[model samples]
Target: MDILHTLNIASSMTATVFRGGAGIATHPAGAQPEMLLELYDFEGCPHCRLVREVLTELDLDARIYPCPKGGKLFRAKVLELGGKTQFPFLVDANTRTQMYEAADIIRYLYSTYAARQRPWYWRIIEIQRLLSIIAGLPRLGSGSRARPRSAGPPAHPLELYSFEANPFARPVRDVLCVLELPYILRSTGCPAWGASATDPAPGSRNRARLQARAGEISIPYLIDPNTSTQMKESADIIRYLLRTYGQTENGQTKK
Candidate 1:
């Protein structure tokens, strides 16, 4: 792996550790919404991170619309839809529910889908905010700001199999956010690390499908139908995205 990319992964690992691996496990949701869930959030926001972890824990997939700061894309859409600018807004068309505030969102998700009371730890939103902010420090400012998009969005939303707090997955998500790419987040959360590929949670449908399709359960796996590319490994994915979307028509790479 490239040394800087290795360091980026290491920093992400530290962030995951600081958050206590909140998104590491999959809990069976009471029901999957008939309609897709929509999440409006940026990658680096602490509150957004919390909401994402819960989504993973519940093993729910959602359509992710990245709203990175200074982004001209979905940021405006969120304001128009919600009547205000919020970092982590959720819209469940299934229930005609639209709301903001990470704490409230977490509660709504648990009550609506999981049909279980929030765990004691998850209930402590204050502590969660502190820890998540601290967790974000290692890669502060990244995935928070938008980079200019040289290319328009894909014909179809990309698909990514990942869980929140995954060291290898975080970087890929960051790039997607920066480029303002919408995607289907396939929540492949496992009960534990090191066992995710060899042995996943018994109820993890995403994991089983991933294993059968990819021939393994290794994560941060990306499928870009627009380009007909399915790939693994964060480094390669990042390079591919930058090359495809972060470059000028004249073939100049843009930061």
Candidate 2:
């Protein structure tokens, strides 16, 4: 990797420190959205980080639109729809509600989907904002700008099996953010706190589904139905996304 890219990945890894270790922990929501929730936010935004962290806490999947500053893809769309450009804008078709502000969005998700009040820790708006900002410090501007797109776009939204704080998974999400590609975030973080709990153990009650589908329990998996591809390793997944969607000289994909 180039110096800039290496620094970018290293910065992203440190971000996991402030994420409260929920990235790989999936505490299933009481109910999943009938339609996937749509979130418009960039990776490096502190406000956006709060919303995504809550998503994993609730085990809720969303179709994320990366609205990095100066991004041409989704930022404009958010402006036209919400009447102002904002970070962490949430569109919930289930309730026909589209709104901004990270705290309000977190409350809505927990109350509506989790069937409970928002967790006490995140109920403090100021605390959430402060921590999220600190979390964004390491990888400042990494995922807050749109990338150069040179290849054809995917026919459909991709699916990624990940949790927010997974160090290995952060780089993949960062790439998607810059590319402004939407995907369903399948969180596979374990619920328990023991050593073996990091993996999707049987006690989590979700591991069986993963084992049956993917043949083993592991995360940071990328399943691209657009190309009929599924992969587990983080490094390989990054390379695959870049090869398929990255800009190359002469407008041809890397091969």
Candidate 3:
């Protein structure tokens, strides 16, 4: 299992390389919005991946609504509002603006949060989209489709501290996607010890908070306020998700 996990993440890392560091660190969103941003996306979609990358890079937090293929939860809601079933649709409550298309969402994020123009690479639109498709190839649709499960919504949005390309973090995001669970994605694109004036911190509490819980700061740290659990290590986190949410690690559904 460990070897397979390593191989899985290695390919995810390779996909990150292909993305050219889009979600690697914080870029200091200009005048943060009071309302949390919302994203309707599935984990394995290349188009959705680009929008998520920018969210991490800008160090912005969002309420993620996973709309995996064939998922009944949020797909209908998206279609009702947007008039189509599209992944990576963004809704900004702060501005009451909603739109589709990866490139457009990226531009909106930069304009609204980063207060800058979209990067040049994004200008080449076609190439960027192609690379995103390639990135999803390795994960093989782990978060691309929904699965059978029984559960009720959490009282609060689960928070995840993850950088877009963290191989370890990808699996957690996948499970969250599969369950259609909403989460606040807190990105550590530029580590605290490495942040710049332009690149702000992911969050102040993340470092100290993880240290207190995991004995050291780490990526893929999960904070499930509903369960009052904070921990690291991907496999353990997956198991906890199953148990806390009522299921088994072997993929058996619980009633």
The candidate that achieves the highest lDDT relative to the unseen native structure: 1
lDDT of 3: 0.78
Cα lDDT, all candidates: 0.89, 0.77, 0.78
Give the number of colliding residue pairs in candidate 1.
0
User: TM-score: which candidate is best?
Assistant: 1
Clashes of 2: 4
TM-score, cand. 3 vs. native: 0.87
* Clashes (N, CA, C under 3 Å) per candidate: 0, 4, 3
Task: List the pairs of residues colliding in candidate 3.
Answer: 24-189, 25-189, 25-190
Regions of candidate 2 where Cα sits further than 4 Å from its true position: 2-10, 22-24, 193-207, 249-252
lDDT per residue (tens digit) for residues 1-255 in model 2: 656657756776778777666445556677878888999998888888888888877777789888877777788889899999998999999899998999889888888887667767876879768877888888766777776676545788898877788777778888888877778777665674542542443223345556777888777788899889999877778788877887776766666
Better of 1 and 2 by lDDT: 1
Tell me the spans in candidate 3 whose CA falls farther than 4 Å from its real position. Answer: 191-215, 246-255
Write candidate 3's Cα lDDT for 154-235 as tens digits.
7888888787877789888888888888888876555534543232244433445555666766889888999888878888
TM-score rank, highest first? 1, 2, 3
